[model samples]
Target: MDAYTQPRGKPHVHLVVGGGGLKVTDQAGAEKFGDLPWKTDLDWIRERSEVTVSRLAELFGVTRKAFYGWVEGANPRKGGSQVRIAALRAVLATLPSDLHRTAFFGLVDVNFTGDASFREVFQGPVDDASYQDRLNAKLAEINPEIESTVKRLHRASPSSRAFESEYPSA
Candidate 1:
């Protein structure tokens, strides 16, 4: 979908780079730098996640040149494969803001036995159940009350008809 278009039904991730620096927003226009467990500002993730370009390149599974291009504001959706882009987005979503820079860098760099990289871990077959489970676990850890409230709000959200009637599709 185009930048201005919103996905049908539930909220969708939206990434944009502007004067405010790179910002990730949901369909509700809520600014979500990152999600649970690994929340951090997009600028920090882009500039400080890795000590060097090569390391960042390895994490994203892209060439140093390409990584530089992305750093210079290349759109992953337009310049990279969809699966890779999706994996990158998912990995970024979990970066905790409170995580130590060194620790966060190390976490993404050290490829575990089966996992190749943070991107690789989420690059498997399209299965959101496992992702959701991880998110839920992190949410519980961070703030169970907020998690419960969000669930309640989601459950109480307007139906598709009601939503459509309120905000007609463009």
Candidate 2:
């Protein structure tokens, strides 16, 4: 007989993920939940029902391949365990102007969401024309100083084309 001959039937293993609360058919099945148990052959989990493959896989470092294989399945899955998305926009709005990284993340969040606050502050409420007019009046109070600064910047700087070319993004 060939030294590398295969065993009779494949090992009797069943993989269950996420605390072994349920039964899984393959390593791939367990992988969706990021759990990979390779302890028993298909027989034990299905036939004997004594020692759960979930508990026995601990003896072997099998979670990697087994779980990842399931992850690669056509309908691979994932389980939630502390995977959090930051509420960056809300947090960033409150940050000081000097903290630019927060500003970047905040901007990203704002871009990610159709945030009403930003739209309200920037575009003004479409339904509230009077409020917009009031806002424009307040903005006008800050205009003279802004105009003077713009004029000063123009006077001190290079040509508009050159400036545009220098900082095309702005």
Candidate 3:
């Protein structure tokens, strides 16, 4: 396992298993919230979440203009909004790329109890490690099939073309 803190003075620690995947952990805890890695690819997030920029901005509690600026290369202010974006990205990264936007948003908007959805619950200042742990637990309870499918996808070749090229006779 190759473990190291994120770059640009970000406080999160990442463990990269050799020839495998990355695992992000909050090594510095809540004290490091100010230094959490908020810089991420906005385009990727937009594509993955499949939501309009306005809705995305609303989700992070920011204005459309501000979100657009961030998408266009401006750095978002370091604070709760950025933390929420980070949290959303963390959750999205766990899901499959091909999942329908409706299903994805449905998961996000499903009521946790009577009054709170995953979106409402994961907002504001959050402890990264605890949040990820809880998210994993919730996902497991909500849809075990998604987990199994993710595992299967990870084990299989991502490119159908690669498979076809390799087995031309089939």
Candidate 4:
């Protein structure tokens, strides 16, 4: 069977040849590629948002196992998936880290952009830059005080925020 088509939980090898016949393999089941950042990004979303792996998979129209691989440091097969993940992270970054999961869902469910929910807008291919700009502008228009307040709270000390922040460099 082709390695990539194997079922979940089964060990599979991926070979990448380049650089004068150089070969890369996933022998021990570790997805060693450009996957470190994927793991980190997924971790960040799980830590700060209501977006569970299942929800993410559904939103991106992929299987839950796919997200598991991504969280385990596996690079997505498509560049579009990577772009969507990055875009979601960027959108979430605008909100306060202390926002509760329920609040996060509620906030994004609002149809601020048009007829579709933010979830729908993010689920498909679109102009990310334009979407972000419109989303931010609409949010600010709805309530500048709330937007500014959330930003301030998101930057506050860990004690005041939902998640801990790293210490500054010495």
Mind giving the per-residue lDDT tens digits that candidate 2 earns over 55-139? 2222122354443343233121332111100111222233333223222222321322233332233333334445444434433
Candidate 2's error at 43, in angstroms? 61
Kindly give the stretch of ten consecutive residues in candidate 4 with the minimal lDDT sum.
160-169
Give the per-residue lDDT of model 4 (tens digit) for 109-131.
Answer: 56654676656666645545575
- Backbone clashes for every candidate come to 6, 9, 0, 0
lDDT (CA) per prediction: 0.48, 0.34, 0.59, 0.61
Q: How many steric overlaps does candidate 3 have?
A: 0
The runs of at least 3 residues in candidate 1 whose Cα sits more than 4 Å from the true structure, single-residue gaps closed, are: 1-42, 48-50, 77-99, 109-119, 125-170
Better of 1 and 3 by TM-score: 3
Best candidate according to TM-score: 4
Q: Give the TM-score of candidate 1.
A: 0.36
Q: What RMSD, rounded to one decimal, does every model reach?
A: 18.6, 20.3, 14.0, 10.9
Q: Candidate 2: where are CA atoms >4 Å away?
A: 1-129, 159-170
- Global local distance difference test of model 1: 0.48
Give the per-residue lDDT digits (tens) of candidate 3, residues 1-170.
Answer: 33564345655664423211233446654343334255354666886665787777776777887777666444576465666666667777777565533355556656644656666666634655576666656554546545554556567846568877888984
Error of 2 at 101 (Å): 23
Can you give the lDDT of residue 147 in candidate 2? Answer: 49
Tens-digit lDDT string for candidate 1 (3-58): 67855666586776642356676765544322322122224456544467676567
2 or 4, greater by TM-score: 4
